[model samples]
Target chain A: MKKVLNLILFLGFTFWCFAQDHVNSENRIANRHCLDCHGQRVYSFVNPDDGSTVRKLMPVDFRVDSALFYTGAHHIFKCVDCHVPEYDSFPHPNQLRFEPMYACLDCHGGDDTYAKYHFETIDEQFQKSVHSPETLNGFTCWNCHDPHSFRINQRTGESIANTIAYDNAVCMKCHFETGSEVMLLLANEKLKPMSVSHDWLPNQELHFRQVRCIECHAAMHDSLLVAHLVSPADSAVKQCKECHSRNTMLLSSWYRFQNIENRNKNGFVNGVLLNEAYVIGASRNEILNILSLILFGLTLGGILVHALFRLKMNKRKRHE
Target chain B: MSEKLYLYPLWLRLWHGLNALFFLTLLVTGISMQYSDIDFPLVRFDLAVTGHNIAGIGITLSYFMFITGNLFTSNGRQYRINIRSLFSDLLAQGRYYLFGIFSKQIPPFPVTLKSKFNPLQRVSYIGAMYVLFPIVAITGWALLFPETIARQAFGYSGTLLTALLHIVMGFFMSIFMIVHVYMCTVGKTPLSNFKSMINGYHEAH
Candidate 1:
């Protein structure tokens, strides 16, 4: 009896250890340690170009919504992992800009790392993007995705709805409403209105909710990677055939954010990815459709010829 | 004068009407979803999805009703083809439609108590209901619950194959609908067969 009890106890202990390894809990307190000040109204700065004084609450000014941070990609990371020594001290010096504004390439730079998560191409693509060649001041990854807010392996387990909302929020942060840092930044540059009106797209809001704005605005290619280069408004994918054709971008966009293993050599974006929900033209099989159309045409022709023959036979019988 | 017979009983008529309604709705919604990006979609893409799902449920239920009704009634007997002469009879019927009918040759076989459907009709209906209909329905439901499909042995790629099969079968079913409607007009009077369907009576000439 004692031996059996020991075996059961050993099994129970092993199970507990396995469970602990699988469940990764976010260290929210570590974030709060920094937010305790950043959350309060303590920072202000005068814009050199616009002559406007920018003073606001720490979390709000920096666009750090704590609630969002808790559920974000970096939730599992400690604040110290990305921060510099200057940020560790209290009452940070006035001259200190955001210390350790880590660029995406710091870790995800080399070809090996980029092959895993192809953000390197995004940098190359951005140069030719619609915002290119003439932004009053240039921008980088941090302009759109703040390193603190951005998380690695972002879409591994996220819901499609949540993923879409998060993607659009990144773009709309500057483009939708005024008074946003992004808007202010764009305005300061003296660039054209970053805000766009996509009246032509059917069910515009639903499309916005279903897919990222970058999906259409970016350059077209075999891979789902959004070319960081924003296309000019006129160059946007205006022709429906671009997506409705046999090769559709909508079919592959969802595959881009997933693990690299999902892709294969046979030109399938998400190799054998079975979507529960259909995306209109995206689900159509061109070969099968063409074959069915040919069948329909032949059947129609046969019927018409048969009808004419019958008509001729009946007319002759009447004459007889 | 034509011989009047009460061939389509109440249950058969109900099943036929319900099947027609469901199939038409499924086709419209399915086509709309397939071609939504083309231009001026028949219905909004989201609404098309909603309608297709509802119609799919209706089809599933009606399909069950059809099978059950056939089992319980004499109507099921109409679909049973005699294997001994099936091939020859099918050929004869093919000739009747293509050459004999235009030449004013009389029909080889007429509707009787034991055989309501001629060889061609029987083979087509059996293949459609038993083979094609089930393939389309099973695949459609599989698509609706993709998580279940992913869990199965076939996994993700299997789900794509299922969707492809469903779409191809759906195309055939549409063609069947067109031919079936046209055949309805092939009776002595164009409206004769249509009236018989409504009143549960078929006239034998």
Candidate 2:
């Protein structure tokens, strides 16, 4: 009985040690993510022209936490795989701007990185798009998804899954209502093309679908830095291109602002600074024409009859 | 003694009366078609459609009759568009009604057997004959079957676009009807023009 008891005690001790080791192994990379704000010294390199190039010393830096490496499918990637230039000094990016943003092919471009199979044609098309080279809000897979905190446990409220749920709210911020409706006059034929081309969204979709208007079209701006903004706050203005692709007379946001200033000096100005009416007024007039026709029957029926009667009696005399 | 000369011929009278009747049918049936919400035993869709089609056929056929009659008649010269004469004739007619008629003076443009229509009547009649009515007919025909066109052209066929086009054209016609009614008040008497149409005669009193 004493020998059996001793055996049990030894097995229990071993089990406890194994459990302790597993807990310690779980925390491979503890805490890492991008910093919300760069410190004052980081802004010390702003030229105000290009709005690029910055130097060290920020309170926060946006980072990919090492703790996530073990949990996510990205456990396949190394620390330097995404932040290419900062591979050596990952836990602390020694150089400030060396952490390049969203280069898809750099790690995956070659023979080994699945570029040979999964994304060969798509990558080519993506590179050719207006969104290429950082024009389109630099849309990367990261823009739509958060890799590590993709799914959450319902009961515990813990985000642990790897499948990324899409976040469209990220786009809604820029495209809320930048369009100047131009002066749509009910139903003018001249304004038909402009009005017909525009897809007016229903009120319900604004709340539920939350689809940004500019997702497909080009963003309204001269450049990224000095982009003249109607409302720097709402997403509707710039994000219309998200789906629309067509804003002719292609004045950038900066030029429109310039145009607004010229108009203001001439003693005429709209608050939003574009009169969509000029573009669509002809179409409104066309609708009015149709209205005129409807009223024609009411007002002219008697006159037509009088003329017809005169014509009829003349014909009768000729027959006689 | 007043001029009791006959101004209209037999064929013209027949054509005019039939045209007037067709217009009435069209007006009644067209209104019913627009406001389908109103229920009447006589105003079913098939009945309205039959009336409308007959009217449409009458209007189209009469269009030819009027054109040929206008071309062959000696009174055709009265319909010539002399821009200088047109402006003066319009003013003379306007003044006679506004100042002369209220003053009970003799009318400015007298009705003659040789020139049945005054300048104002001539131009408006021409527009109705040439431009306005044709638009309604062509657009109406197209709107009646938009799917056939859309199917042949776009490959996807549906009534949505056709219905929208029909409604739009219908609205224009309604607007024209309102303006047409107001102008009838401008005649020799409020019902003078009305009487003339029904009787095929205008006594230059």
Candidate 3:
């Protein structure tokens, strides 16, 4: 009886393991079913009343770029996971729209674990970002980063040069490319004209290659992680003196974050850092400069007056 | 008889002349480099950098010559400060410049074989040579090798700190030059001190 009971227990365990595998395999099969139609179908319509032809959601446009999707950070997820249980059905509903079918906040909002995993504060930061419009209109994450192909930057082990490249690439997708069609639709008149002539800047190529555009363009702060508010091109820092100065805006980001302890200790006493390259009229001790200037003016003035007085006295003496 | 003293030796005269020339050159080139983008143009940006670096080297060499020559001769004694009498001597010198000099009173501290500088001159010279020159040179070199100063070793950025020190020192140097030229005119004859620097002869009582 003991041997029979042990054999039965082992069988039950095997069945449970098989069930778990079946469920995972089922998700994959369901995703493939949805992709098969989405990959090939191009829904077309003709208006009989106006005798007009229209095309909507062509397979070329609607279909996921399989090559990108397979290798993307989201590749681990099946279609149903984000599309929800409503999308598990075959051929989807005839009048189904993907926009109302799924929302990004379903899993992302309200949970600490998801927030940490995503490195996203969602609405808290996005609302205050430069892109936020006066009305309830602005860019979603999908505008810049495609949901199907979004990848997390591996900043921890990457070299500084590589990290900078990765971050800038996102902006350059629109900014660097000449006559970006997507930019026209999204940014419209708000797009800042690219500075084609960098005549004022020295080593322009070196600066563009190494530094992120956000470094100078963003608002000043101790932590770069939260300073996402980008200034418009007109208001952006174009002056060399700003960075070249002792109290540079460059110190507000990466350098500041890296040297947090030192910054905290020295502090910005007079809008100047004591232990950094001092900029004239920027970061150096202002009191010392003022005192020295006063002394210089007084001494030089005194010398001139004394010389004039002596010359007048000498003339009087010589005449007598 | 108006006695003429052979005060400035040949080496001292040569060192002084070279120091003045190189310092003026450095000042001009530095300003050019600093505001290279601006409308003012004493030299082209690249040329200004080259000239500044060359002038800096020349100043460094002249400075070393002055130090070596002074170490081997009595000229070094002129800069030696008597800490005890420094404040009082400075006050007396200040008073003379303010009142006594105009009234035709004899200078309390006169230039002689042992004492070429008054108390004020000795203090200013020491500060300029030992404190200012070293700082300017070191900081200027720090900017040249940005990688070395870029890293934060201590609590602050070495590059920035060095730059600040360099600018401040340069300011003091400018003031020193202005005052030194003016004080040179305070000799028995305005041209006498200028002639002494060139020909090694000064008017003496």
Clashes within 3 Å, all models in order? 6, 91, 5
Residue A173 displacement in candidate 1 (angstroms): 17
Order of the predicted models by DockQ, top scorer first: 1, 3, 2
Once model 3 is optimally superposed onto the true structure by TM-score, how far is the C-alpha of residue B10 displaced, in angstroms? 2.4
- In order, what lDDT does every prediction score? 0.70, 0.46, 0.67
Off by over 4 Å in 1: A1-101, A105-264, A267-278, B151-156
Tens digits of per-residue lDDT, candidate 1, A79-122, equal 77777656676556866674546777776777684574676676
Clashing pairs in 3: A246-A279, A276-B160, A276-B161, A277-B160, A277-B161
C-alpha lDDT of candidate 1 relative to the true structure: 0.70
Give the higher-DockQ candidate: 2 or 3.
3
Q: Find the candidate with the highest TM-score and give its number.
A: 1
lDDT of 3 by residue, B130-201 (tens): 889988987877766555565444555455567666776887898888888988888888878999999998
Hey, what RMSD does candidate 2 come out at?
Answer: 24.6
Per-residue error (Å), model 3, residue B64: 1.0
lDDT for each residue of candidate 3 in A1-320, tens digit (9 for 90 to 100) = 99999999999999999886674565456667666546444544466679686555644446675446655667667886676565655345765574453345665677786655443444444556666554225566565567676665532333345656767777777676364655666667434445563445654555675567777666754423434566655677776545544456656655454344444655655224443333322344556657877988898887789888888877877887
- Pairs clashing within candidate 1: A125-A229, A126-A228, A126-A229, A129-A229, A129-A230, A130-A230
